[model samples]
Target: MKRVFIIAVAIVTLLVSAEAQKQKVGIVLSGGGALGFGHIGVLQALEDNGIYPTIVAGTSMGALVGAMYANGLRPQDIFDLVKAEEFDKISKIITPSGLRRGSMGISDHKNILDMLDKYIPANDFDSLKMPLYVCVSNISKSQGEIIHSGGRLHEYLLASSSIPLVFEAVELDSMYYVDGGVFNNLPAQAIRDKCTYLIGSNVNPEKYRSPIKSGKDVAMRSVSILIYENTKPGIEMCDFMVDVPVNYFYSPMDFKHFYEIYQIGYKAGLDYIKEHPEIVRKCKGKRPDW
Candidate 1:
């Protein structure tokens, strides 16, 4: 039943995202969840890019990390505990904490998180208000927004479909501090000062305006836009990410071959969510708070 529900949710969410691109380019955006910390840089970069894109940040604890914990991999704790290629321990964490992990709100304290959160001061986000202090989570989704990642992931899929991209906040899910608190989306306060229903947090109408918001999760109202088809006339365009590389996708970000690394990451993200439909279909589940 759960698997079937998840697949159905995945199909619907992807379909909706696929369908939203009405203009020259259809853009979807999201930040680090499946991965961690670096996603923030990606978001800030998007913000810095003159184009104002709709930003939808999710809570790391609720839909994003909670789901992972429920599934057992303890995804939020990945950074602090496993410093390097510790895939074995990672896989093990998921197995024990999965929905099948038993128990209620929290499954096992003995499970690495307790020790990691307790002994390791790095994972906690109290009083740190720095650039990446809101590290509690990588992706954003609270009790209500299960489709956050899927929605953001959809943006990348659009690029893969070759729809003539203007700008996309690519592979943002695996880039931020997943286990910390995030009030700083003070990375907060929209720079555009004022925006429309679709515009995001960092958008600046006087600039490379985008209808995306950087801190929320609701989808945009369907409207006509000549976005990706062609960069609007007079709109100075730039693709800073071109040479940026795929290293961001594979943490400890390798400066070696930037674009190539991110290129791989970009594709991997698309393939991952698409291949694992069950994982994405979330919202419908009974949450702990409820």
Candidate 2:
């Protein structure tokens, strides 16, 4: 009888240990314009390994992807949306007013807003399946704002990704907002306190290998330098990071290379997962065939 009691106690203790080890994982996605499309591939790889984020935080392009995922659209669905020719038309169709913006931006904000309206199912944070924190730069205040709620979801997405000089700033509640990458490109700090484990995906290239030939290239390279400098702190906060190898040649507006970039992201994610067996162990019983 004593032996039976000892065995029961041991089993209970093991079960308790397993339960305690189950952690709330949060993913932080960094901004990289069209390179951000790679985030979808990383997310797909995570799902394939049965690792789903309990919370997600992002800046700029990251915010757009994170918001869609938080609304319950699978990565594959997002991939399809981005790869479709319709997306190319909508994103590139510039209005005469947009072209004449002189110093504001070359593209129309309404085009992307219309795209978001058609795709995203939810309009508010509370309605989402998972908590999503979107980081945007409050240009009026010269500060970064982390938006977890309030205002329209699509507007927040637009504001978060509104690249300075490329797309016009989004106005919300009488405040002007622009790309979050100008402040915090990798917003790991936003979800650091919310999750027990953190995963970060950085799509920015480590260095610019090509010459800056155009005004657009100059803007992109300048932003890349700023984002790269500010990303160190966020990198240190992650338990694991998937670094997608996007290069200088792949401009922010290179929608044509979305599939190639996405595949690179997937491979990077798989490589990270293989290297971190502890992550796999933690997600036991949930593993899917890769």
Candidate 3:
């Protein structure tokens, strides 16, 4: 555990170093727009489907956030104000221009992943296991633009939990976010990239690993659950891969914590990718030949 933590930190530190070496992009704001980058996985997905960002996208922001938190910011410092519904306080701490500018709305996190291709391939794009009612109730009662600000708020919560958030995990939240409706459906554009899906009722026979074609390492049933140990080739039969522990998803954290774990894993994956772009390409491709 200690070694894993150390390695994760080291990777993040290296990514930050690389990011700092590059010149910062110009902030094209509407007089006071605090800029943020899109998630890398989302970017890869977009590229896979022939979609790319117009102005640097969110990948840069996700990378920068990873670098910043791993180096400059502390989980406690950002969260104290956020839990108090002080979005500005959290943003001010991270954003030099004193705002989130634009986030999780017009340029949401998941939309980015659904558009790109990850070279490494991942099973992180599965359904979410959050408590629907609590999330919606919180969204309705919350004091902000429920879509954008609320999304950012969830991000704050994720950061506070010491879990790194990423584009892929954020994508899962669009359908499974705390406030996301249970019976409600996603918008037309949102599910556009779901070109293919698989279903297998009995995967217990051990020879049924098929649906999931992307070969990946380290999969999770959710934020608190570990589906397979690092690099274990999960079962595959037809259109879906099998072998992740279902109990992992049942362990229970509010929708917020689930998102946090997703963030942590996604962030780790992205950091690994930024420092390892080749890996992202394969993962985002969905069904890689490798």
Candidate 4:
């Protein structure tokens, strides 16, 4: 009887291990300022429900949180970090002059980079426990690229978050970089073919569409189209699009608004997964072949 019990326990352990290996989840995070910070609650809800991504690809602010998550920080910890005054101080550098002149005068860029490094040192993306891919806009070529294999985490984060004139373009290895959203807003294309399942945590509302009228608008739209076409295909897609007003992106970030944004994203994500039982089932290791 003792031998039989031990065998049963070993069998159960092996089954659990196999299930874990079979589950390949990819989380795609979108850009939206303090809006993007809402991803914290979305991630929290997923984790609460036993859903954790095996891989993650994020744009702009999403990349910042994703990088921290990849480095082993939990959602609550990320929230705490953001709530800290130190993080808010970084945004103060984006002045009206910075936007008009295309320069953040003081190079708070360095300060931002330094702060991130203090908490999470620059490490190879491939070396992270869970692989994280950061989507960045290649300014020189006006294209989108995923920084997955290896690079300074700070550089990747900076490149992904640099919102054109608002935040000065970062120079690295002789190339200028800007926000990834300019090309791929949600960055769904970054991990489409790399995983069996994908969860797109988008802060941008689904109904919001760009009203393009000018020459520059057309060019931006064209770039978006090209990047969208290049994004990989053939993955199970689960979308969580938060309903935030267009004006919110232009507003200043504060604890009150941050909390509200988080609630909006968290509820949307929770409701989405609840309605889509298939997504929940996949995350919990119930689907083996799909």
Candidate 1 lDDT tens digits, 45-139: 32232222222222221122222222223222433233342422434233334234323222222333433343332432221111111112223
Candidate 2: stretches off by over 4 Å: 1-23, 88-97, 101-103, 205-220, 283-290
What TM-score does model 2 achieve against the real structure? 0.83
Model 3 CA RMSD to the hidden true structure, in angstroms:
21.3
> Could you give candidate 2's per-residue lDDT for residues 1-290 as a string of tens digits?
99999999999999878756544788999998888888998999898888878679999889989988887778898887775525543345344356773546766677677667777655778887778999999999999989897658888888899888778778888889998988888999998877778889988857434477889778767767878877778888998888887654576677667778788889878888898878766643442222
Ten contiguous residues minimizing lDDT sum, candidate 3: 25-34
Model 2, position 166: C-alpha lDDT score = 74
Which segments of model 3 are wrong by more than 4 Å? 1-238, 241-243, 248-250, 253-290
Residue 147 of model 4 has an lDDT of 87
Most TM-score-accurate candidate: 2
Give me the candidate number with maximum lDDT.
Answer: 2
- The per-model lDDT (C-alpha) reads 0.26, 0.79, 0.24, 0.68
The RMSD of every model to the true structure, in order and in angstroms, is 21.1, 6.1, 21.3, 8.1
Distance from true location, Cα of 2 in model 4, Å: 45
Estimate candidate 3's alpha-carbon lDDT, on a 0 to 1 scale. Answer: 0.24
lDDT of 3 by residue, 20-84 (tens): 55322111100000111112222322334432221110112222222222222332322332234
| TM-score, every prediction | 0.25, 0.83, 0.18, 0.73
Error of 3 at 249 (Å): 9.9
lDDT comparison, 2 vs 3, better candidate = 2
